[model samples]
Target chain A: MSLSPLGASRSLAAVFLPIKSGGLVDEVCRRIELAVETGLLTSGQRLPNEIELAGALGVSAVTTREALSQLRGQGLIRTVRGRSGGSFIADDALPSPERARARLLDLTRLQISDLGLHWRAIAATCAGVAARRSDAADIASLRGYIRPAAGDGQGATALAWRLSASEFMLEVAAVARSARLAREILRLQADMGTLTLLPFGDPAFCEHIAELSEAVTAAIESHDSGAAEARTRELIQTTTNWLLAEHAAGQAHTPGTTEEEAS
Target chain B: MNGNDAAPATAELRTLVEGIEGRIDDWAAATTRWLNDAGKLSGSAIDKFVRPTVSDMLLAPGSNVTGAGFIASAGLLGPDRSYIAWWQGEDLERVDALANFSPQSMSRYVGAEWFKVPVATRRPHVTGPYIDLLCTDEYVLTFTHPVFRGDAVAGIVGLDVTAQTLERRALPLLRRIGPRAALVSAGGRTIVCAAPDVDAGDVIGPAEGAAATPIGRSFTLLAAAAVA
Candidate 1:
């Protein structure tokens, strides 16, 4: 048996891929999930028949049927039975900032700080690696992602602006060449992206973020790992500091707290 | 350092360091099957057949497949070329935007390392420590493998894993090597540094007392026992 980390050897193919679990049904579910999560299968995009899908997967059609049922149960895919109908990615609702805010309010300042440290550690590592690993094409791509998104009075526009920064950061991770780092970044962004909004409608905050993006891109392009990592830390620290302050102030202003202030 | 003082810690380190390579190799091997699966379908079906598999694999409790999807060859999907299903998660929620349809031009992605490296190498390779837009909106290492149909290359398939997970899981193991021990990527990016003065993200160079050990094919964990 191959001395696989965390367990016994299972499959020849799994040796080259980091799989945390085993089974054909699990594999089928994994592939379908990869498609939807990657944006390959958009909301409402139809999937092929079970026989064809199973052929592509190199698994039996019965396995494909089971995977489809699992996906439907997870609400990731829905099947419509009729002419011109098949499995399609379920339409997910847009992320709610209120939900993000509530999540933030639930966390303590120390938890926020710990989370920030994790973010900085991941971002800094990526930036440092990216600075050394990137080539001309990499530099150009970084610059391309930095181009400013329009942010008028619209909420969607504001959200887009925030997502643009998040996307740029992920691009830096891609250049780092470590899949694990990229996944961590994904977790951080998913948890904090909505909460990291630029104090919506605050033009000054927007401008600062845009400038931060430019500075980061320039640092990565110059191959200055130190500067890239430092800048990334600055961004994370500033955001986390603001979040903690907001949480504290919100608590201080809670309804009954005014009575204590009067006393 | 006294012999008795250092012996047990050194032995414990050995046990923890033994099997990392096999694990990474295992994950990389599984992805080849995914690319092969994509090859069986038409280029248009790349997203439909090959993309969501990434999300499913990542669903495994400890699996680290971040963003998994296919990027079609330039001409296969026609002029406003199409590449879809690059699913990534920032937390538990799935966040992936279609490449060609976004308001901001993703035209640049075609030239990004994740796309260009696999196409150029025609072999399964790992590239990054760069931001991966399609997978995570943060630093990630993307393992990309080429998908072929017939004699020509059809597209590229990939998986992404973020650095934060590595640091969290691997740092403590390195710390056990010695009080000042640390783990760093092959590129010299510090994964975890035990010294109060040295921290993650610091681009550390060769050290006088450091002993470096390979942690899989991508990282090195260094331990330095300070002496008077």
Candidate 2:
């Protein structure tokens, strides 16, 4: 929905860039589906019209229509008729394990490492800033997200946990009091998608990450910027390391694998 | 030093403030009339009354308002709790924030500066260039005006214009004042600046060569022309 008022929509522009060459219909489907799964297109958010979507993706309206049909079939989106009606993202359009795994494997080892380095740098800075600046009330907001209200078993799902983590990190960025910083985190969160939080779905890793988050929160509460930065770095680094290990193991199984081949 | 050189920037700043204040005035007046006539109403009723205006404000061509709505005061709505009817603007559609209206979300904004300043002072106020964690999640400048029923202050009517929007509007005028001028809040938060070393939302230390020109009641134009 381009929620960040600091023009984070500019980052979203990357999602709709004209396709150079590919299966037009599949590429369109993948782009929109990826945007939805990543929280770039939020729940109940309206999609751009077929003609607009086609123009943006540099595809024919028919291809866009076919892609929309595919998305509907997958339950990723639902289209409504009549005035004030359009295609909307469904409530449970969360990333699947198989999709997330394939996406992780699609990246080379170096690309994964580079993304981690970039994301961690911004996240660490955001943590320090949030530590120094967030007030009691701001902390009240953070408390809502640090641990998902796992009541009713709904929050036990991977989608809920990933969303909670995303909200927590985004809230931290907001509390840091910089729209620019918050916008960058939102963009990176989309870039990493649920892949970063794939580990959060596991009970053991979830607990470990929650413990690290507690340290991060405590540091922010105590206004310890250094510890906040360290904890934030460690939190993301732990996730990156796990993914790297998985990527290496997957590579070992398929010799001479490339991203295209893996996908 | 000359009237001609100083006139344009000062005039432009006034225009920008008026453009925002004009919207705040209409919102405040509308809410006051509603509260006075209908008495303190439920959050939903208030939302119903304000929704049309908010949509018009957000969707209007060239509008800078990212969100705008009314927030009722504590206890006036039965329990010792307040509720917000804030609507946040996005590209295609508006986001109805604080959708749950659970007491937790409502309580978080009760202490916000935009609500507090207008309530305490019993006058119109401008707040932030700070993150609006309550609604839009943008670094926004909130324009708040008090809504009263008789002598009792019922609540606040507030609107947000993103700092990015403000920076776009103010940079050229600030440049006219001095290449290094900044619109700084009373609390020293930089709202917009023509300087590279500083940014919006930064709490800047007083630079040695800086001077101030009052921009209405809320902010000052800080010029650091002597340094560079």
Best by lDDT: 2
True contacts kept of each: 0.18, 0.29
For every model in order, what is the number of clashing pairs? Answer: 85, 0
**TM values, all candidates:** 0.47, 0.59
Chain B alone: TM-score in each candidate?
0.69, 0.86
- Reference-based lDDT, each prediction: 0.63, 0.76
Query: Which residue ranges in model 2 land beyond 4 Å of their true spot?
Result: A1-122, A125-168, A175-181, A184-231, A240-263, B1-3, B39-45, B59-62, B74-83, B88-92, B97-104, B107-113, B116-124, B150-152, B225-228
Which parts of model 1 have CA positions greater than 4 angstroms off? A1-81, A87-92, A128-136, A148-159, A174-184, A190-194, A197-203, A221-226, A245-263, B1-228
Candidate 2 structure, TM-score to reference: 0.59
**Positional deviation of B71 in candidate 1, in angstroms?**
6.1
Candidate 2 chain B minimal-lDDT segment of 10 residues: B92-101
| DockQ of candidate 1 compared with the true complex | 0.10
Q: What is the lDDT, from 0 to 100, of the residue A68 in candidate 2?
A: 92
